[model samples]
Target: MHELVVTPLGERRLVLRQGSSKALQLPKARFEELRTSGSSAVPQWLADAVQARWGMDVTGRPVDDVLLLREAGPYAFSRATWELNLGCDYDCVMCYLGEKRFEGLDMDGKRKLLAVMRDAGVIWLQMTGGEPLIDPDFPKAYRIAYELGMQLEILSNGSRLHKSHILNLLRTYPPTKLTLSVYGATAETYDAVTRNRGAFHRFSRGLRMAIDAGLTLDLSLIIVRGNAHEADDMRAWASSLGLPFREYANISPTIHGGAETLPSQSPEYLTNRAPFTGCPAGVTFFHADPFGRASICKVGRDPNIDLIAEGVEGLVRLGGIAESLMLRTGGCSGCKLSGTCRVCRPMAKVFQEAKAPLENYCQHGSR
Candidate 1:
């Protein structure tokens, strides 16, 4: 494995070190030069920059030894998020996925789907799930993505992260980011929220194990009704770990258009969001479900294109799908308050489909 990766991201180019989000921008001409520089020694400037930035000395190394290039393709997507499976050990009520069904591609199908993603120009990939660590096929799939030259980020609940095998896998091929969601500060509250007894103990054990392994990690502090009282404790705990954390308070309807997760939202913790702006979901990135169904984003999953059947050619339709989903249509058509809308079009559509309260999503609430 090369110490550095150089990949084309849409029209942009980046030089990234594995296990780190920080990247150094490369000019398109410079990128192309390196791609064509076969058997050439590492450039003096690049070696110096890499040494200064990442403290890795690549002065006398061959170009191939130091840099791994992920070639761009005719296909459009530069980033993608793939669901390895929808199976979880702990059932969190506030999960965006309404039903945590154990379904998705088998090992063979997973390999094919990841290959398609790579050929389609997906340089940055996020492997997510109903708790990706619990999936039996996770280790191989994770390794596959890494070997494919995709910068990976794993979204996990941290329940099974303490497992020796799991840690070994992660330690061998570190992800660019490993984001774990923290439900509560205490064991009792944590188990109560996830409806899994002894979950907090396991969660703590996983954190310690991951830290001891010297793995890079980020925390998502899930602020919900059950854990709202312990908000300060959660923040303090994250600070104590010295890991960067982000708070998620505005719980949305599930991807299945169900209102189940909204009630768990903590009203006091709710933060006002900026007005809706245009998004580049299908244009720049897309979400792939367990079965390899590609959608504009996670929330806008319908009218999907099957990646297995169509391959990268399926992504051609995604731009149109994204365009159609973003337009103000149906009940929202001709709305004069669109400028003041809080959420994006796809998100609004999900809330509308769920029959969520008007006050939760609309400016023209019941008067």
Candidate 2:
């Protein structure tokens, strides 16, 4: 379909993509206006802005409302995340994979998995890690996904990105964006957080090289007690490099069932709350682990269906399973803290000991 697709860009903005590559960014209010009016005529101001920024001439281009709304539909699985492998070169203290060995599909198996994803209507695919670049078959898999017309994203620690082979592959079939996880702004704090003596230098070098190569890059700060003090510095560093930056404070239990890296919630972070309305996991998005085991998300990793065996049909069937999993169960049903309870089914399963109003999560409870 040669129609514009709209996706949310954070809470305040929306991104519109047409065909395989062209895209335009619009403010939430302007996007709402277009959605409600269903007007084919593009406003002169918006058209000029798009042309000036993205160099797309949409002066009188007709916007396909039906296609746009269809993509924006709640049931659409337009985006998917693939954990390419659970292996990494660095052993960060806060690693979610924790000691999990890499068990991803081989080259042939990955191709089959990509075909299934394409059939399942995933247009935007994020290849993540332990370290996606370290996966031996990543280049071929990445090229295959690009060939299948999927917008690609890579999440890495910037260790192998500077390698000539890796740089060449990226140049050949560049991703829409590459997100690097920055632990700290300085070497001392970075090494302390990552526990790799020369990691900071390598990460800095690789990130600089990639930027110099003119690759689209972004940064995320993994906020934890050890590196939280450098949050401002990290943001400043990203800003100095003219790159986008985001910070994440919450830490879930590792895939290996270890909570050693789960940090104490800061008072400011603890004030934020999630609504009782169920999460958009299996409903709109899904995650496949290294071995092609599909789950709603990494944290809520129950009901792991083997996507390799069941294919896209199996992914469709996960909706019912997801609904079942969302039901409030023992110690969760009608709890006084339901309004503010951070515990979801998968999280309860992760920390079974804290099933009943986790003391650490409860703001009223003593820390």
Candidate 3:
């Protein structure tokens, strides 16, 4: 497998090395030159640059052997997130995905889905789910994506990070980043929140193991009612680990527009966010469900494009879908506070469908 991947990112291009975080920007002209350089040996300057910057001697190797070039596409996407499966070991009441169904695309389906993503110019891929590590075929699927030349990231709950196989897989490939969610600093609050006995112990063990293994990891401090009392402890613990962390206090309704998860919102921890800026969901990136159905993003999952059946050609329709979903129509038509609204239109619509309290999403509710 090639160590470096050169891919187009909209108007610019980038050089990314697997299992590493450093990136080198390439201008369009230089990129075009390299693109036309063909399957011959790696150019001396390029090889020397890689050596000088990364200290890795990739000299005298075939261009194809040292670099994987991702051709430009109509979508201009460099980032995409895939939910491998919707199954989780923990039953956190605040899960936005209400149902923890452990069903999704099989191995054959997964390979095809990943190939479509690769061809579509997706270089940054995030593999997320209820708990991706628990999937029986996670190892195979992850390896396939990694070999496909996509920079991989993982979102997990740290419950399985202690497993030998998981540690080995991550240590070998090294995702761009592994983000683990922290529910509480104490086991009592953690188990109570997840409704899973002995979950905190498992998570703690896995976290320590992952840290000891020297894996790049970050923590997402999820503030909810069950663990609201331990918020300080959680931050202190993450600080003690010397790993970067961000706090997430605002909870959302389930994907199906169910209000079941709203009760978990920690009122005291609610934070005011900046205005809702426009996003490049479909224009530059998209989210793929487990079955290979692509949507604009996680919040706007409607009108999916079936990649398995339609292939990469289906992504052509995503741009229009994103535009339509972002419009200020329907309940938000002529809203006075459009400029300062904290949530995007699609997200506001989800909150509305869930009949969530106006204070949770609407700027007027702040009055």
Candidate 4:
């Protein structure tokens, strides 16, 4: 038998190579021995993972391994998302859903969704829209989510949030986090991107209102070719406002509706590919549409496979979808991109339809 060895790649991640054709990964409690100077106490939590690959426990096991395999799998689904509406008041050329009402999950639909999420063990819920605040019953929906013991997040344009009722809700049932998409630093830049006149002022006021209300805030900046250089400017602005910033490569043009207004991904634009990695779709997280269909990603929803129809357990069973999409070529062999690619499959398909070795948009920073 080959000896077991450990390599510390990064602080949080440790690689345990057992000389088997396949690598055995031990994360968190699995690597406690290596962390504490190679102590010999076996981690009960990881015995399943170790025995599955090594065919033995810290001691030896005589029982059947298949029976043990049945008992272990990925973490429970901890988050649920609602893509509220496709309709948008602004026409940011890079806006993914575009300006149409591609779908709508009204109050009744949301209630059903809440129940489904709770049953699936989701304790975190997000309400997203062209602008969810535009929904008349937004506050009530948020309250219902709160009542269900789910931490909430609003993926919004941050314009209608100035309403007294909406602001009061922040003080009432604050979300776990709020992601505000800020387009530009200057009024012309912002108005041009959203294609809404006076929208800059409205969004600015709303953002300030959210800050004053003490809501945790995060800013998302869509980096388009025309707007790539502005990322730093947006970051500075967010910092000035005491908010954290994140950059998202604009995938609006690649998805269904936004295709008409923006250009498709070209080799030049593929410079931002997330380091090649396995598609972690069903493993790290699962994306479901407004109708509760399991999608490959937020931008790759197929109505044919409604997760609700399959039921929570059925959807959970498709966890291998992430592993199935992994392929390697050229310099990407043995690169970190192999595993990291799972997080950005939506953006990957935007450039080179899914199932192919394509570039991604979020590759600007190593994940």
- Clashing residue pairs, backbone N/CA/C < 3 A, model 3: none
Candidates sorted by TM-score, best first: 3, 1, 2, 4
The digit string of per-residue lDDT tens for model 2 on 93-201 reads 7676879477778888899999888767776889998889889998889888876656788999998876899988887677888899998899998998888888899
- Kindly report which residue stretches of model 2 are placed more than 4 angstroms away from their true locations once superposed: 1-75, 263-271, 353-357, 364-367
Candidate 1 whole-model C-alpha lDDT, 0 to 1? 0.88
- Model 1 spans with C-alpha error above 4 angstroms: 363-367
What tens-digit string does per-residue lDDT give for candidate 4 at 145-172? 6665555778888888788888898766
Measured by TM-score, how close is model 4 to the native structure?
0.65
lDDT of 1 by residue, 1-367 (tens): 7878898877789998878778899888889899987778999888888888988888878898778898886767788998878878888888888788999988999999998998898988999987788888899998888877788899988888889999999998998888999999999899999999999999999999999999889999999999999999999999999999999998889887899888998988888678878877999899999999999888889889999999988889999999999988876888888888778888888888889987777656764
Could you tell me how far off, in angstroms, the CA of residue 310 lies in candidate 1 after the best superposition? 0.7
Superposed Cα deviation of residue 151, candidate 1 (Å): 1.2
TM-score preference between candidates 1 and 2, better one: 1
Tell me each candidate's TM-score.
0.94, 0.77, 0.95, 0.65
Clashes of each: 0, 0, 0, 12
- Deviation (Å) of 154 in candidate 1: 1.1
Cα displacement (Å) at residue 361, model 4: 6.7
Give the whole-model CA lDDT for all candidates, comma-separated: 0.88, 0.74, 0.89, 0.59
Q: Which of the predicted structures, 3 or 4, would earn the higher TM-score when compared with the native?
A: 3
Native-structure RMSD, model 3: 1.7
Clashing pairs in 2: none
